[model samples]
Target chain A: MPTPEAWAESFTEATNGDAEIGAHGKYYSCSYMLDMQERKLIVDMHRGRVENINLDVQPLDAYEFALRAPADTWRGMGEPVPKPMYHGIWAAAFRKNLSMEGDLLVLMQNLRCFTRQIEILRETGVPV
Target chain B: MPANGRFSPVTGRYVTIDLEDPDLGGEYKVFFLENGEGRPLVCQHTAGCHNHQWRGLLEDPDITRSHRVIAYDLPRHGKSDPPNDREWWKEEYRLTADFFTKFVVALCDALELEDPIFMGSSFGGNVALQLAWRYPDRFGAVIPVEAADYSPGFFLDWWQHPHANAAQVCASGTWDLMAPQSPDQERWKTWFYYTQGSEAFRGDLSFYSVDHDLRDKLEEIDGERCPVIMMTGTYDYLTTPEMTAATAARIKGAEFIEMQDIGHFPMSENYPVFKGYLEQALQRIEERIGATVSGQR
Candidate 1:
């Protein structure tokens, strides 16, 4: 079973030097959740930087939103070249394959950052 | 701290020149900006909009320190005055490759800029292609964003609507195709288009949608002396990635890059993503120049 914990290092590798993320201002800070299968990923972002990513932890809840989808859907979204509706989180939501709950503001605020984060999963090959 | 808070105010100046075509020939004031120092980097704005598109490049320390970024407002656009003979709105306004080519070379000569790197977006992109084809050895490199040989159906009802409100409607419709995520940028772009001289957008479209076509002329371009890079944003509905890719394929040594999650107006819509692509393209140009120098040695 693959956990979000196993995906953190790879996610960091894909995002750190990305031009878009680096240009965002210092006030851009947020946290969110990615729920697939039985695990929940709590990703912490500060000043447009990915600070921490924890998995399967519920002791302290600091997440602004949670994006839930079938594990198979996550796998489809994880494909190197995702098909039309499977390419991005917004697209997945639009197709009704993924449901977003809580703080829609934060999710939309950091949409590009989060979108690129998941796309990086394709590069990481973490087996979803 | 210029009028726009995001970037520095570029120094604006005007140069008067005579047009080649007698029917359209007259003294016209061409407005351009000169910012920073080093090798010249000439930027052309998209149709309708002014040189404000290059605000980011004008302020970027990395780009400005090594290159003098010069952006000009096309005739009947921004601060550039109209030709003495005709009114831009009342008469049929059209742009031809011949006139565009002459204007670019003249601008260079007037400013004493030699072999500057040419960078443009949309209609500006099409003009870049024309420049490359006309003067193969005149430019250092050609970087055209969202460039395509032809953009069919870009103006479906562009000038067909009621004259009074047509410009607003056209400008408003484009707002959706710009950066969907960024509101400030959208406002800026819409305002840029809205404030254009009536029918001026359509005038430039005459080139983008009608006159400009280099599909058969790509062979004439000397890619070795002037490296051509066609960059297309993924979200550009008018000039899609497929179109740019096809154009690049025809040119033997041209490079095509698809910018991710970006739209038609990259510099205005998604600066970071667009800048990333620009830097990468510039790096590639540097490598090619170095290799050429070494090869000749």
Candidate 2:
């Protein structure tokens, strides 16, 4: 995962003085609100095609934004297998518009593992 | 014994850079800084890095005056050669950590060091931590700078994610992600490039995740008579100060220092600051050890 400094640098470089990106907490490197808005514009420009957009965000934390991402882009970034919470969140967000898949169930299992990992981090006082 | 000289024993793969210590009755690798007296501070370079990595420490006359510093190239790096058959690279790939551990032990034994202090940067730092963790009895103190704490999911994530420098890592395989310039560096690069590409090494990459959480283990070290110091740069993307601080807080007496305006490789980027910080840490270790010895006496 990129450090908050790296995320801020990248965000600043991407926006080029147009906007300022700041860290909210340990888990989220860049400002979630700003990232969401920028992602929306990129998605719109790509005609809602997720693959056409470059998220340019921290790869590990991409799951935060994956919920609002197009299905194809979400799948391309490892789908539900790697980050199940993200998949779950995506499913819940698009449940009315999309159908759930069996692989996604497996993703739920992986998400459980992710949660366990997070718990471990918390127990160890890793600040997420 | 010669001062500031080089030694290439045909039997050994590496050409040792010897920093002469007349009082010690032998010449050791350049990785060590010798006080014109006999006392020495030993250091080992991480894979694909060199003695120059610790050049900052050497440049500081105060540090050099007090401690003899020694550093050497690991097999297949620096002056070290690739195994004659090259197949040995594959066999040796899995043993990098073990080899280094043994190397440090042997060096200490050969030097008759009662309890030597160790300082490492990057991969060297990881090796140093592991060595201390496994054999806390052997070291007086340890300082790991930007050492990686790989979890089970780290590599899998790396494989899945499209990295900014994926192509380079994929091509070289060795963890010397830092760019280098020089024939010596190129030689080091080739060593990493080959070993990282080896199949045996690939499987062993999972070893990084084997002990994902070393907080408890480090805490035990803190309780020991020996001291442990964790150092990192504020801007170090690879190993941030926050991570180092967390690691430090876990250990009972582990000291954490964050060098400002520096990144992953502080020894190279902020040499003066790194040297100053290291000297301070060593002074603390010396005082602690002295107090312990005096109390026993």
Which whole-number lDDT from 0 to 100 does residue B6 have in model 2? 68
Quote each prediction's TM-score.
Answer: 0.65, 0.52
RMSD of each: 12.1, 14.2
Candidate 1 clash pair list: none
Badly placed stretches (over 4 Å) of model 2 are A1-128, B1-38, B82-86, B90-92, B95-97, B148-216, B291-297
DockQ agreement of candidate 2 with the native complex: 0.03
Model 1 ranges off by over 4 Å: A1-128, B1-9, B85-90, B186-193, B290-297
Residue B166 lDDT (model 2): 33
Q: How does the DockQ of candidate 1 come out?
A: 0.02
Q: For model 2, state the Cα shift of residue B77 in Å.
A: 1.8
User: To one decimal, what is the Cα RMSD in angstroms of model 1 from the true structure?
Assistant: 12.1
Task: For model 2 chain A, give the 10-residue run with minimal summed lDDT.
Answer: A41-50
Residues B1-297, candidate 2: write the lDDT tens digits.
579886432112223322222211122232233322224566765433445555556555665555555555544444544334334533324334554566667666765666667777766677667776677888878878876443233233322223223322332232222222213343344333433433322333443434334545665554245677778765444455776777667766777887654444556545665677776777777877752232110
